[model samples]
Target: MSEAVKEAVAEPALVAIMEQLPKTEVPARSPLAHHTEVLSRPTHENPGVRLWENALRTHLALRGDAGSADFARGVEAATGLALPERLQCHQSGEWALSWVAPDEWLLTGPGDQALAMEMSLREELDGHYAVINLSGGQTMLRLSGPKARLVLMKSCPYDVHDRHFPVGKVVTTVLAKSQATIRRVGEEDWELVVRRSFADYVWRWLVDASQEYRLSLGHPE
Candidate 1:
């Protein structure tokens, strides 16, 4: 094949590997939009537990060979954050990369940056890898306050004690009968990524379970 023809054929294949985000005018909605009233309720002066929806943030499921140095460097180059170790999380400013499994990781950032971020990853990465957008199908909730750990204790069987699940640790576990990718962000702060279908059930379950500890709606950050 001629050099020009060979280049033309390979270029399309490279570009075709990525699925671009559709441009649309539809407004993004949070899974908990119907709970505006409850979320807007006044918080107690001494509330022990607080909850808020992270809402509409970009979620990308990444799969590749973790052992490959090229893949790791490409990810770090595109994301500005290193691929996290097993059950760990690495964050930089608003971006976070969390280890989900042996070959899978989750990358989340500002809602509006999905397309640009995906493009960057596609451009930098080569060979066998995948980046699938999961934003529209899932939402994140931020749970914090003095009793946040207690609320998690009641919701999941995972050992969330500080010593075991310290800051920057991530785990996928059973939460209130639903599954959640839970990340410990701080001493009292946690981030839970849950599917849209189970968001309502999980939110209400947390609210009810937190009643004893004085649950309150936290201001969205």
Candidate 2:
């Protein structure tokens, strides 16, 4: 056998598996679709907490070596956002990257761009790295307003004070009876990423917790 033929046969074939969005015009339903009626209600004056589901967004669970320069550069090249530090989040344009653990990060962006983003990352990253599509398994909710911290305090044991959970920080903690990856996007605004199964429960729990200060539902920002 010729050396040229052996070399060509030794190279592994690249396999690309792309996830496609539904092609039909059928409307996509959110995990909290059943509560649409309540969410569509008018906001009350001086509401303390404004809540809404940031539905249908792309969520990718990324696992890679953060210490590798190639990994960092490749991710930034693909998403245009730096990989966040421990318990932190970095946002650029429509995308956000949150640190989930020492070697894992979460990447989120517009729903329609998930496939493209994943493909880009796969192409840029080399060696041992993984990118898993988590868009279908989780849902994101936004909580904001004056008493948003109070609502968080009521639900989790984590000290949500600005000094502790400052803006741009992300923490995976217990939220009510479930777990959520909470990100402090602003001084008064928070974003919670929860499993689809626990989304309804978490939403109701938060709404009830905000009742003392007046709760209202609004479109996600």
Candidate 3:
């Protein structure tokens, strides 16, 4: 092999494939459709609605140099997904991209694609970058309906008005006692990005706050 080729091959890969730990099987409980609160439960007072709860899909942190054009393009080329511009989302049919930060974005796709998508990103990306499948580190919940805005306003401070937050806006804003990357999926459908550790707090806060509105919590699974 040429010296240049040897040098290239000698360097270790930039992103590591974080091992896939065995999935936890949450015990099934009584079906309470009204307790839309399951999404936030911490697994004792109420139970966490695991991956089996919803048909929706999600991927975790994609970290890279935000200033690298090649990194941005690599993501687009890798997943047929593009990084959202600023605090907005890019949706084509069912899939959407939400900017989580200057160097990261969240990919929402089918549940089955969660792992495969991360692999594709790993293979497609070049240079120094990282794509760790953090699906386990956080949970995504859908709080949507005619009253979704009113319900969200109870905790979030972002201007949820259609004029300020159009249908495609995404933001990292304060949520209850924690923080969230909130995105608008539709007029009535909103997505919340919350840490797994704080799931209980988020669920209880939402349930108590939305009780006055008769909000319905659901997974539609």
- Most lDDT-accurate candidate: 1
How big is the RMSD of model 2? 3.4
User: Per-residue CA lDDT of candidate 1, range 1-221, in tens?
Assistant: 99999888788454433333355786557889989877666777888998889888999999999999999999999999888899999999999999999999999999888988988998899999999989889999999999999999999999999889999999999998899999999999999999999999999999999999988896644
C-alpha positional error of residue 1 in candidate 3 after TM-score superposition, expressed in Å? 25
- Encode model 2's per-residue lDDT on 24-125: one tens digit a residue: 888878899889888667777778888999989999999999899999999999889888889989998889999999999999889988888999998888
TM-score-better candidate, 1 vs 2:
2
Question: Top model by TM-score, which number?
Answer: 2
Of candidate 1, the 10-residue stretch with the lowest lDDT total is 12-21
Worst 10 residues of 2 by lDDT: 13-22
Cα lDDT, model 1, residue 200: 97
Worst 10 residues of 3 by lDDT: 44-53
List the global CA lDDT of all models.
Answer: 0.90, 0.90, 0.69
Error of 2 at 25 (Å): 2.9
Q: What TM-score would every model get versus the actual structure? A: 0.90, 0.91, 0.76
- lDDT score for candidate 3 against the true structure: 0.69
